[model samples]
Target: MTAYILLEIRRTLRDTTFLVFGTGMPVLMYLLFTNLGGGGDHDEWKAYSMVGMAAYGALASAMAIGTGIASDKSLGWLQQLRITPLAPGRAVTGRAISGSVTVLPTILAVLLAGALGNGVRMAAWQWIALVLLLWAGALPFTLLGIGNGYRLTPQATGVVNVACLMGLAIVGGLWFPITEFPQWLRSIGEFTPAYGFAELGRSVVAEHAPAAGAPAVLAGWLLLFGGYAVFSYRRSARTA
Candidate 1:
């Protein structure tokens, strides 16, 4: 398992697109938002935007990992692995483990950049909790990405990636606060995985409050997406 995970991590690191999107984009967005002065001068708003961007970065990483897995399947990687001692569960676990390991450094770099560049602050415990929450938050979306990758063609995977990113950005309060959005939008955002993640992030960095309902929402998403991944894996295995 450890060897498989290390190989996966190395593969991810060698991917140019993954490094660019997972690391570069978040840092670019953070700098843009902070420099543009659009988030307002209020410390709270700055903190909110900083944490939101970090959470968004995490989501992007999860999506990329998931889609990459799908691409791998399309390219016969999973098929080759299935003939080995590595079972489906262990394969997926390695993917998830390696994805998180690769993406996490970028997430932390974003947070640190926010702190040093934008003056966002959090206690040590809050920072730890935020990291935990971000990882937890990525799991469901990663599973969803895996399911989508397994089920969709390469071109379709690109379309779904765009749609998923836009949906999460708009509904998860990355573009704007849920409080300012329309009632219906807010209602939808409240139930979304991104919203739960954003709220948890904000709670830690901005509000200094506990993440109340985020764990449950994230867990529900994990279960839902995990089921889809399992189903897709079974169907694909049979077809293969």
Candidate 2:
């Protein structure tokens, strides 16, 4: 399991597309958005934007595991794994762990851009908390990715992942403040995992506990996605 987890992390790092888009894009977006707001006058907005982009970046990278898994299945790598000693469920879980691990660089890249580029400052503890919470919050998306990988063809998974990432970003207010949305839209966005995930980090920046609903929303999604991933993997196992 440890070996498999490390392999997945290394593979994710090696993917040029992931490097450019998953990790690099967030930093680029942060810089662009902050510059548009004009200089250092909006430190608060910069911090808020930093959290939003970091969350989006982490979410995108975590869900890329689905495409990787679908590609592996297409190439018969999963079949080769059957002869190994690793349990099927354990292997999938390791994939999720690895996906979460890969989210760190994306989070760091955006945070570094915020700190150096725009002077978005926080205490040392807040910096640590922000990274840890954002990384942990990506777990549900990683599980969702696992389910998609097992249930869809590589082509379909790729398309669905792109849509999912964009939809979540738009609906969950990762691209803009939820307060800017109409009341009805804000109501819907508040329930999304992406919204809750970003809020967890923002709460750190604000130096307050996250709202009670944030953890509850995330926990519910985590359980739902975990079940979906397990069922999809088992169904695929039987079919294979």
Candidate 3:
């Protein structure tokens, strides 16, 4: 298990594209949207803008991590891997670990930008809570990607990844607040995992607790995605 996980982590580290998309792009977006605060109490501004930017970073992490499985399938690497002693479900387990590991750099980079580039600040507990929440919240996106890989081809997976990132950003209210959108759009955003995920991080700073439905919605998606991930691996193992 350790060897497999280490191998995946090493491979993930070597993915320059992953580094750029997951970390570079998110930091770039943070700089572009610092004014997202639109002038308010400094702490609140930091909280709002930081949450928005971090949400996008989280989106990138999820897409990059999830898409690799589909890419490997298209290349026949998954079949090749089966000849090894690595157990059937272990591949998926490694991928989930890789996905989580890759998300770390993106999360750290955005946090740095929020602190330095935008002067975002908070209580010690708030900082710890927000970071921990975002890190833990990223798991759902990884699972979503795994489900996608099982159902789609590599080419289609790539397209869907980009679409998911952009669509989620727009609808999840990461690029901007859902409140700024029309009532219909806002209603739509409420159902997205992006919204649920972002709102979880925001809770650390916001005066109010998250909506009761947010965690429930996230958990529901997680279960759906996790089911597919397990089923996909088992099906592929049988075929292999």
lDDT of each: 0.76, 0.86, 0.76
By TM-score, how accurate is candidate 3?
Answer: 0.83
After aligning candidate 1 to the native by TM-score, how far in Å is the CA of 199 from where it should be? 1.5
Candidate 1, 150-220: lDDT as tens digits: 77776787679768877877887778778999899788888888887777777777545646677788789
> In model 2, how many backbone clashes occur?
0
lDDT of 3 by residue, 121-209 (tens): 77787777777778877777787677677657777777887887788778888778889999988998998888898888878777467
Clash pairs of candidate 3?
Answer: none
TM-score of each prediction? 0.89, 0.90, 0.83
Kindly report which residue stretches of model 3 are placed more than 4 angstroms away from their true locations once superposed. 35-43, 82-90, 180-188, 235-240
CA lDDT of 229 in candidate 1?
76
- Cα RMSDs, all models: 2.2, 2.2, 3.1
lDDT of 2 by residue, 31-92 (tens): 98779757567778889888888988899888887988888877777767756888877877
- Give the total clashing residue pairs for model 1: 0
Instruction: Show pairs that collide, candidate 1.
Output: none
Query: Least accurate stretch of 10 residues (summed lDDT) in model 1?
Result: 231-240
- Stretches of candidate 2 off by over 4 Å are 37-40, 83-85, 180-185, 238-240
User: After superposition, which runs of candidate 1 have C-alpha atoms over 4 Å from their true positions?
Assistant: 207-211, 238-240
